[model samples]
Target: MLRQVQKQMSLHSILYNKISENHILKKINYVVDFSFINKLLEDSYCKNFGRPAKEPEMMCKLLFLQHLYILSDEKVIEEANLNLGYMYFLGINPEDELPDKSLLSKFRTQRLEEATLDEIITEIVRQCVEKGIIGGTSVSVDATHIEANTIRKTPERLMKHLARKIIKTYEKENNQVLEEIPEVPKYKEIEDHTEAKAVMKDYLENVISKVKKNIRKDCSESIKTKETIEKAREIIEDPKFLNQKGVRSIIDEDARVGRKSKNQEFYGYKTEFMMTADERIITSVRTADGAYVDGTYADELIEQTLKSGMKIEEVYGDKAYFRKPILNSIEEIKAKAYIPVSESVYRIDESEFSYNKDSDEWECREGNITVKKKYYKIKGKSRPDREGYKYYFEPEQCKRCPKHDECAKKSARKILQIGLNTIEFYEISQYQKTEEYLEKYKKRASIEGKNAELKRFHGLYRARGYGLLSVSMQSKLAAIAVNIKRIAAIAASKFCIFTLNIKIFSQYYKFCLN
Candidate 1:
């Protein structure tokens, strides 16, 4: 049954009271508002269940502590049992039994969904915003990699393992030994990497086909064999089962190969964050497979921030986000973008061409001829015209120009593709050349520090668990802990300032009255 413990002046309580008041746990307990979590998770529990569940708020605090101190589940529970500061933060007596590590894992995987986690983050941000700790006007966006928890395996080893598993399962079900399993090709036989990869893929496909044939032939003999065959079929049909690059990891199929530099490659996922520039508060976060490009998800991240009730006046990002669609999305929301233009944009200098909005024509530098607007099918397909406007210069005009050779090759016309957000792009490009843009763009540097903090301090460089969902949960929890710590620091500083002002006022009043 759910019950609240009665207040008592126990020895542990008196000792906690006598402990230093400047402890981080004491400061966090004084400032942070964790009560909202109880309401947020209220619906997750059943009124008529088998047993009264552990309080969700306490469980959330446990998770926050886990990331805040970068402790493992076992270590966190053990520390909570032994440390008075941890017990004080949890509002539990020293004798209280701490929850087991399995229960914490169950709470993370079963009780907390992505939406609930998001809600908790949003509520925390809201409180900070209300208290003027975070200004929601401008935000910087960036992404970092988190290594998955798996050991790298070669294609040959993975294929052999799969084959062996199927063979053992078949033998165990039928109570009969097979003559021999499929043999994997040796690496020495294939000299070229590409050729070897192709051979391995073909061999695996053949093995799967043979296994299916055997299953169909033996289905009538044993139900167990049929069940085994069905499970094997599901594994083979899984989209993440295998790819051209080979299996990323047998343990975590969702992870993909990611390269930070030419020399640094890892198997993991990518986490993107949008944080307020003034306070470094994380506004929104997204998790994707390692193979996803950083620029591809800017639109979604911006939308998520907007949905969380933050007014985005401006966005700052690196050149990785210098794509047409991303710039257009920012303009659609009427927010300014501080992203630097890519070299491709500079190649087509807009200064050389004058656009006529009324006639939909672009006049070249010579002003004697105009480039005509045209729409061509992209990639030789007929449907869904391209997103931007393509302008083609007259071949005759280009041929006569002094810079013809520099601008275009012989028998080729000069063409420029301008997106519908061309005006916005031009504005951004011009602004990038100004002092204001440079100063504003500096804010993007802070997100890099936040990424470093997440990796270096909170253990985000490598994921704590396998699978995309588990890693995503880890990212969110880390973000929450960072925000909570930031809030606590801000609160402590404000309190110090307030106390100093009060003391000064009291001393001044005493002198004036005397």
Candidate 2:
């Protein structure tokens, strides 16, 4: 089933209510406790009022119900009013009044703050760590884009064709009869199934032209186009608004969009997350701009997570992460970067002295490099790019070489400037010529499956909310939600084992009687 019930907490609800009601405050893992969340918001002005405080235990119960049921505050309040199970879960009687929904919205804006969401995610991660859901050996890393909260568009970003339509409006005198004024304000309710964005592009362009003309006509005697615009036109020129759309919401605008593939487009900021191999628990969540290329982003993600106090033994990812920098980082950590090597390098000079096959003579492609100052040194090139890197070619050898077009470029002798680590990793990566090495490279496929699960099942493909903080909160909840589901499955399997053993006992008893 698609799990579409947004808010209905009846007795028929599959998720139970009495799951997290342990008392006595005894040596519990505070990380998963609702009280921890309460503490996060306790300092806010909402709780500092003269009104009677919600009993601490009752507050914890209400929050726990929200977490498990994935309810918005409004939904939770509604369910508590209608459902006996929900009321009972919150330590309220069948007769007690439900809490108001506005309380939560106000609380988030006035008190809870952005850090509370972050703390909730952190606590979930802490619980996963405590439960051994995360291990250092193998983590599947992937990223997705999310739309920014800004619904901004600018005249400059409009297609050249679209801009022409706007300008031509100015070329003609403005008549009282305008082309088509869209509901003039908001497009949130304007989702026409037949509407193409290209149409919106044209509409916005025309709108831009009228607005500019209005600015000119409305201009004051002092500043021409600047002094007489409305609050709306002033908004049209806000540097943040590259373009404009949507009803005025007090937050930023712009639905950042990106493509995962040909038809699989998503509107969201990209989030790169890593999941552990053993239990499929998310280790970290990283949000990237929708525009960053995946392969290049792999190294940045791996570096962040590794620095965040996790021991990473291996990284698994798809072709999007198969890059030279990613592989080199893996080698630096002595962890395997599971990526398939391209087989285009069909022939390599495997001579005895070439890069010292076994004896380490350190030969150049020509024949051998004479050791200067006991180490290969070059001017200007540094660190990973130094020595064994700046390749010096003999003019005599290169002038007649068959592959000189690619191998050397200079009319004289050519010097190839590259990081030694870069070429060395590329060469070492070539050892996958054998089936044994190819088998090791195959683990990357596992992460692709994990990416599918993270996208489809974990609610990460796109989220319901629009802000960076809101989207981040939803993504973190989703990861922990999946982890909690995994934990529940583990618990259920143990219960099944116990029931199976009992069944066996009963059968054995019946057999003895017969």
Candidate 3:
């Protein structure tokens, strides 16, 4: 009976109205990337009421597709509406009332405020879970510098820089000749600073040839350059005290000059994020002032993601997040923080915590005493400034110790900042020996790939908005778009799998007849 019912099933049966090929073609033809647009509309809410309440679902889809394709409002209305593929994917028609860019912008703003920018990201994440797009494995936590639209150098900043150079230039040359004073840009900010070092050099050269002897001594030309750039950097940092006369950067408070992991330096804001390995799903992200340190933000972010209900298993970060204090934090969360050992903690001696040939406990570096195992509550004791805690061999015991110089301090006790069960310490420690930790730990690098996708694939390198808020908003949107793409990819994969299963079943039926 069951087999007969299965055989009677009609493949052509429709779940809803039979969407005509003409209707599909018209909707999709005028559109941009059909698949991405389709993904943007995958959510039921987006499919149902994405457009105005009075507007048809098809029209709403076209507007959203326009947003996904990044077509200007005018372009989306005139060009996209005419294409069949775009129309079909949008579930809209050429005859339907098309939305202008303003309309699109308004809806985005509304949704952004209502659902919030992270809603799309949340949706994408949900899809990833449902489709088995990600493994609850290790994720990489890192940050990238996003260039701000502010000026690094200002005319006022330049004049302050140049005045010192002028004095130094005159002193170094011995006042050999006279030359015209150069105009200084006192307010040039950041990348917009017009005067390069070469121009600065030229100005000094002129001043040197003119008043070489009149200038004072005790400072070299290099000293002058150093002073000028230093003062300029200071001025750039504090915008409230602009001394020069020129336009200021639109953003100053949150923008900072920071270095990336690759050693490339830029003056901008920072974007910290976490990404899973399987599909590179960004689990969490933060936009911070450029002065923000990746190391400083890790612990807080760990807490936040946990609060968000993301079932974290382990976290991976570069040397930056190898905070020793975070180890206990990992334990508290029932998760792990996988940060690498920092070079700053190199002076530590682990011999005491080394493999005690018999007990298998890690010994301290000082091979002095037979045993010195003591655990103290972390709250009352001051945590040393190192990545791990500073524990030591008994100082009195170290006074006459043989490995004193190598392991113990003469006046100080042998202390090591033992990392709290953080995943970073786990890498070199005995933790990775476990299959579960190793499996999750290997996936941390995936976040770096996610960063690359955001910048290279999504065009999020330089934020388009003026203030940090705008930049943050744009960054979140890019994340949302990436999430949308992931959802679409999952949906497409499911569709493909469904088609394959049907094909296999048909083949089985043919064989049975034979």
Candidate 4:
């Protein structure tokens, strides 16, 4: 049930008004009209007839405050009870009782539907657009990683964890400990991971089968036992079960190992977002497993940004977003892509080698030209034939060259592979040399700052709870928090300008009268 609370001015309303107009809480309340939230969440609550529920708006406001200040559930409620600023932000009178902290956890994980979180972000962006704060057409996109809540475990340990969880649940629910349990394997004595995994798998299967057989014939009596057995069976049967990446932990199944760089890896999730350059306000966000490619979400981000009422005239990102499909998606929307070519795809040391566009060959500083070329078509069902080309230099020239050791040590000749879209990338590379591209590309840095702000201030540096759903909500709420902050600053600046104009007009009128 969604209880509608009528807010009449309390005696403390005067004190709330006394909270400086520039106060972050006051500014946020003034700029962000959360009335739309009630309508958006109406379906999630009973229309009537249930115990009077806390207003969805207030519940959501509690969450917003939680993320905005990076407070734990218990801490936020404590602050709201004691702090007048928090009370003003939540729109509750000082005398009004705040809901218990447990209700917040329930509201976040249960009452608030996963899909509604995205709508919440879109609504905020829409408000920004409607308020004329986000009128820019250029948006920057980027992805930041969030560390998983659980520590990573090896495949062997992960299997053991699963087996133990099932057995524990069975024993507790059935109130009978099975004495004839499967014997543990000496996995540490095994040298090969494959052999050890096979033995461990065999052991786990035995344990599961034994538990199922011992369960009372009335298996329907314990749904938890049945569910645990089913979940364990699914994990054991997965194709990637033996691989370390399959299920790192039973607690967080959605998190996966992802590369931050070639040599760096982190187990967690990714939050990809697009924000307007001029306004620095996030327009759209997507959450995915840590291993998800940054470029994969580019199309969705652009689409969502468009849906949020921001016209994207240009899109900016890092080299990871230089894929053909991503660029094509941007082009389809008639937005120019400012993503630089991936270094792995097209990189040449300007001082060492230069490309001759006329001959379609590379020239080394030693004045040697490439003599042979081979086109290696990408063999993939989803990709086009134009993958790239490999250019080979003459072995004889390299053998006789003075810089052979420096340029091609232990090799017969010099070779370079260039992407098939060399022309398009070349044009972008050339444009990268211009003042216009430099100025426009600078907008991409704002997203990095936003990412830092999220991690440093909004508790996005790590997952506060288990599973992707929780992290997704955390990321979106952080985005909303920052957007509200940006909007308030903009509104405050506009107000300052308006006041200055009025003062200037008043001075001019007085001078004329004199």
Candidate 5:
């Protein structure tokens, strides 16, 4: 059951009203209405039965303050209990009781879902759109890395730790120590990592096999024992387990090894978002493992922004978003993409050959037209030039050409792999020299500042807890807090106050001086 919390008169609230009326929280409270939170998350609670729970709006407001000031769960409650402005913002009297810190964590992990968090952002952006805060049709997309909370371990050490955990669990469940356990591998004695990994793997497999044979068949197994055995088996069966780093941590398995640059790597997750070009308000956000690509969520971000009633006319990003599918998706919505072209992916020499658009073939300087074409999909893990076409000329034509010695010296025929979007990319590369593209591309720099703000002030530089869910909630709530702050500034500048209704504002402000 949802408990409806109503503000009542109190001597402490009366004494502190005058000093807090001019506070920023008071203006924020006047500009934004948190009542939508309860209604948005109304389905999360039991409406007919059960004891009354803390007001969903109040709990969410607590979260807003937590991320707004970058305070921990326990620290935010202690600060809220002491600060009158926080109480006023939360719509609680000075003497009212607050929930414990554990409840805040529970509310974050259990009561809230990722979809609800996205809805909260959408609703806030919707308010901004209604208030004329976000009026531009241009949006910028970018991503940043967040470090994981667990300590990273090497392959040998990780395998040893997992094996020890299983052995300990089996011993605890069966209440008897194995007399003939496998001896620990002397990893230091081996100089080769591959040999050391193989030895450690063999030792772990022996431990697992020995434990399975000793289990009593007449009784059911404990959940912990079964899970540990399954995990060991899964790790053993993975062909690429030793080839990649940071796949399965003893603590956080969801995190992976991602790159900040070619020379730099990080063990954690990535947060990608879309923000309005003019107002700098984040419209949508997505979280993935550290190795996630930058522009994988462009379509979803643009769709979310459109759903919030904002028209998107132009999209801007770095070279990572210059894929054919992403460009086609943006073009489908009648929006132009201003991403820079990656020279490595779109480089082609146009002096020797010309493309025939009507025939979909290329002609060389010697009048040798392409006789055959096949779609060549790049195999393996490399992403550069993934999909393209290999244009092949007639063998006799190539062998008879004067330039055959230079173009096809060692091959039977001359073959050229042209990028799928080479022509469109060439046009975009030409457009990059114009004034319009230069001026609009300047806006992309703002997202970098926004990323720095998220990392420096809002505690998004590192994960507060393990897993993707907790970090995602942290990121979206930070966005909401910043949006509220931005709305307050815009409202004060325009001398316009925004709220759901005048009645709710008056009820909260009746005791304060004008």
Candidate 6:
């Protein structure tokens, strides 16, 4: 039942006074406003049905405490019971009973959806902005992988195990045993794992076909058998059903294989963050399957930040986000992009030729090259226009030049072909050489520190639950915990400064009176 009434206590309760003056939790309680939480999550609950539910605000506070202290659900409840500060933070009286660990799990998985969690995060950020903790003018974006809660296994092994499971289910459902159950093929003698995987795939396919045919012919069939067949078919249809390190995990199908470096790989999901530069507070977060490239969601992240009412004047990222589409999206929002140019841009050295923007011409030491716009055509039909500039050097001028061999490697005319990105690339390259751009670009490093803080302090390096939805919930809560901690620290600092100034003024006034 909802705890709507505050418990009455003695006027001079020792526990109440002690918790009221606690530094960290006290500051957090004052700085964070949880009154809006219940209203925001009002739609998640039924107004007139079922037994009375736990207060949504208190449940959310419990989740915040869980991530803030890096405690499991059971551990968090235990700590809250033992510590007066935690109890006070949650507005629970000393004698009030705590909810069960199972209830906490249900709240996250069943009550709170991803969008609701996102709204909670947005509200926290809005409060921070109102308190002057976040500048909201610039944000840095980056992604990190959280290890999924699953064991890594080869696709061939996983597939064989799945097939065996299906067969077992079919056998258990019907009261009859199969005449022959296909044995898992042993590839121990095969030195090449790839070739062994292919062999197992063929064997499993044959076995699955036989089992399906047998099940279809049977007069008595159960729902379990039908579901098993459907799952088996899904496995067979997957393109990487039999390759090594292809299928992510049997336990958690949503997680995928992500590469951390050229030599290191992990099975998990990627958590992307857009954090404001001033306070290092995360403005928006998106979780994706680990296999997704970091640059693929750059536009979406920026859009989400904008939708959260954070006015972005500039955005910063690494070379991975230096794509044409991403750059254009940032430009469309009229925000300056501080992303570094890709290494490919360095190869196009424009120092040898001077560009005249008005004439759209490139002037060399001895010859002038004019640009011609080119379009694409396929099968004698004009396709959608793909605009690119083709700048060709005078063949006669190049033949007479002293650096002809260095300039032109082929017998054909010296032509440089580039799309519209060439202009953006040149601009970024020039901007990168200036001190202003370098100073602004340095802010992008703060997001790396935020990522490290999450992994090291909040236990975000490894997911606490399986599946994408559970992992995403964990991530959002971790971000909220981090923001709350930051806000508390900032508020405490200001309080200290104000107290010191008041004491100094009182001392000065006493001296003047004396």
Candidate 2 segments whose C-alpha is farther than 4 A from its true place: 1-33, 45-49, 53-73, 79-97, 132-136, 147-254, 257-267, 292-311, 318-388, 394-417, 431-459, 494-514
**Candidate 3 lDDT over residue span 192-231, tens digit each:** 4344433543554454444333333423344554454454
Model 2: worst 10 consecutive residues (lDDT sum): 22-31
For model 3 the local lDDT of residue 22 reads 32
Candidate that scores best on TM-score: 6
lDDT by residue for model 5 (1-514), tens: 8865565667777856565444768877765677888988878899979998888888999999999999999999999999888888888888888999999989988888888889888888887788677788999999999999987776777788888998899888878786688899988789999999889988888888777777655264656877998987786677756876546587888888889999999989999999987788899999998989888988899889888999999898998888878889899999988899886668666677777767877788888999888988776565554777899988888878888888865555588777778866766777897998899899889889889988898888999888888788878888888777777776676553444456668877985754
lDDT of 1: 0.76
Give candidate 6's root-mean-square deviation (CA, Å). 3.1
- In order of appearance, the predictions have TM-scores of 0.85, 0.58, 0.59, 0.86, 0.85, 0.90
Model 2 score (lDDT): 0.52
Report the candidate with higher TM-score, 4 versus 6: 6
* lDDT per residue as tens, model 1, 427-478: 5677688898788788888888999999998999998888888998899899
If both were scored by TM-score, which would come out higher, candidate 2 or candidate 4? 4
lDDT of each: 0.76, 0.52, 0.54, 0.83, 0.83, 0.78
Score residue 63 of candidate 5 by CA lDDT. Answer: 93
TM-score of 1: 0.85
Q: On residues 315-360, what C-alpha lDDT tens digit does candidate 2 reach at each position?
A: 7775566666677777788887665543332123344224433442
Model 2: per-residue Cα lDDT at residue 12: 40
Comparing 1 and 2 by TM-score, which wins?
1
For candidate 4, write residues 1-514 as lDDT tens digits.
7767667869876777667889887887766788777888888788877898888888888888888888999999999999888888887888999999999989888889767877877777888788886778898999999999999877777777778888888889888777788878888789998998888888888888887777755363667877987887887788776676667888899898999988999999999998888899888888888888887877777877787787889899998998878888989999899988786656655677677777888777898889878888877778756567788888788779899887756444478777787655766777788999898788899889999999999989899988888888889888888887888898889889989999999999999999
Q: State the weakest 10-residue window (summed lDDT) of model 6.
A: 371-380
In model 3, which regions exceed 4 Å deviation?
1-79, 89-91, 103-111, 127-140, 158-248, 251-253, 295-310, 324-333, 343-367, 370-428, 433-440
A best-first ranking of the candidates according to their TM-score comes to: 6, 4, 5, 1, 3, 2
